[model samples]
Target: MEKRRIQIFDTSLRDGEQVPGCKLNAKEKVKIAKKLEELGVDVIEAGFPISSPGDYESVQEISKNISHTTVCALSRAMEKDIKIAGESLKYAKYPRIHTGIGTSNVHIRYKFNSTLDKIIDQSMEAVKYAKKFVEDVEFYAEDAGRTDNQFLSKICENVIKCGATVINIPDTTGCCLPEEYGKKIQFLMENVKGIHKVVISTHCHDDLGLSTANSLYGIINGAQQVECTINGIGERAGNTSLEEIVMIIKQNPHLNFFTNIKTQCFADISRLVSKYTGMKIPANKAIVGINAFSHSSGIHQDGVIKKKETYESINPKDVGVNDSSIILTARSGRAALKYRYQQIGYFLKKNSLDLVYSIFLKYADRKKEITDKDLETILEKANLIKNHSSRLSSDISRHVI
Candidate 1:
């Protein structure tokens, strides 16, 4: 079967930077934008230009440097915001203006003090105005996760008719379950007029840790674009992780979904985002984490050492990692010990290994991890180094004779 290509719309420089204390300057934003283009992101959401002058400059800078991928600027459902966003993207070869308004009841009543009909009107106007500046216009229905499906369908259809090429359904609060989000997308696909004329995009948050799941479900239900950030950084809890969604679609061939993403650049971009943002990626983060491929359990290490596929579904090199690690811990067994020893050019006979294993256990119990230096110390303490050296000399002499 032909694989359906999912456009990866990266918002790392925009939404990802919304995390508290995680801000990037224009130069830093440009650096990341260039990297995102290299990583094969289909669209790069540069920034909300009306938010600040710094953001406008950043978006302009990214637009100037990025030529392959579409450079998108975010805007509210207001003429001023759309105008500024357009001005910021004047140099972009492929420019998109993302403008939208709240459609959910809570946003309609409290956020905007308006009614459903007015909200739809505002959404249509925003898309119409944004279309004047860029041929590619994406309209976002803020808080669409909680918006009534019927009303969501109405606004989405209206935006599409008003020249919007992409309709983004964002679970702004990150509250929707996978099934709920999937059904929501399905409802739009079945109900919205001209839905086939525009791409349905999924913009999910991770407040409930369901962003990635919801995005995948959205795709299964007909969403062709996924809005995500590197390492999942964003407002509040976060957004769908770009690496997670990309790797998921790549690994699951039966899903028949593919993207233009360079999977090998995951680790590099992940590190760059973390470094610029000063947010330390948890060692347990999926895909690019430091410990994602590290094996510490004796059974797991032994199995992985015997066959990589025994414990790991992904080849470390596929994500730019050199190899899987056999970490020496208290739970490690003889096989892991032997493998680690061999890695450092030490060849221990079964008897010598058995002897060293006993001593290693005692040392392991006292420390969280056993280093290569500790292994050498254990060999010396066991008096096996001298004996092994003598044996080596004897073998050399016999061979010479």
Candidate 2:
């Protein structure tokens, strides 16, 4: 089967910067934009230009320099925002205007104080207005997760008629489960007229910790694009983490899906975003987390040391992680201890290994780990008692822990 390639629309620079204290200057945004292109994202959403002068400058500068990926600028349904989005992305060889208004009842009634009919009309007008500036106009009906499915289909139909090349159905509040979100996509696929005219996209929030699941569901049902940020960091509960979604796609090979991402660049980009945004990557985060590749328990450690596939389903290297980690702790097997110890240049036979293993167990029980330094101390004492001091200590003094 010839599987359709999914378009990865990275909003790390735009939506990611929306989180408090995540403001990146124009220089930083351009630097990251280049990296996103190299990492193989199809579209780099630069910023909401009219939101602020800094944002506009970042969008314009990124559009000017980033040539590989289609540079995108976001906007509301208002003409000024769409105009600014268009202007900001104008310098790029490939530019797109992402503009739209709210679609849910709460957003229509409370946020905009507009009726459902007026909201649909406004959405169509926004898409038409955006089309004037660029051939590629993406219309996002914000809070589509909460909007009525039939009405949402109607709005998407109207927007497609108005020249929208892409229709963004966002779970703005992250209120819907995966099944419900899949149903929304299915409904649109079944109901929307001229559905093939535009790409179906999903932009989900992680308020309920289900954004990635919902996104996957959408893709399986009908969505062709996934809008996400790095490290699951964004407004409120954050959007889907780009690394998470990409890993999921890669892991589920039976689904016959693949992204254009360079898997080797995942960890490096995650670090850069974390450092720049001052949002530390949690140790337990899937794919890019510190412990994601570490094997700790004695049985698991032995199994992994013998063969990594015995314990881990996905290889760490597949997602750009450098190597599998073997920590010398109370739970660590003798195989892990021997391999880690040999790095400091100790060659022990089976009988000698038992002695060291006994000492390691004792040391491990006292401390959380039996570090290289502790091993050195143990070896030194045992050898000194035999009036034969070790030579490894002198060689490793400069690189002391």
What are the root-mean-square deviations of the candidates from the true structure over C-alphas?
2.8, 3.2
- Candidate 1: residue pairs that collide: none
Compared with the true structure, all predictions reach lDDT values of: 0.92, 0.87
How do the residues 1-401 of candidate 2 rate in per-residue lDDT, one tens digit apiece?
77668889999999988988778999988888888989999999999999999999999999889878899999999999998888887789899999988899899999999999898888888888888899999999999999999889889999888889999999999999999999999899889999988899999999999999999999999899999998888899899989888888888888778899998898888898898889899998888899888877888888888889998877888778878888788888788877776667666557666777887788888997677678777665544222224344332322222
Per residue, candidate 1 scores C-alpha lDDT tens digits across 83-103 of 999999999999999999988
Q: lDDT (0-100) at residue 349 of candidate 1? A: 75
TM-score, candidate 1, is: 0.96
Indicate which candidate wins on TM-score. 1
As for candidate 2, its clashing pairs are none
Question: Roughly what TM-score does model 2 have, to 2 decimal places?
Answer: 0.94
Query: Any idea what lDDT model 1 has?
Result: 0.92
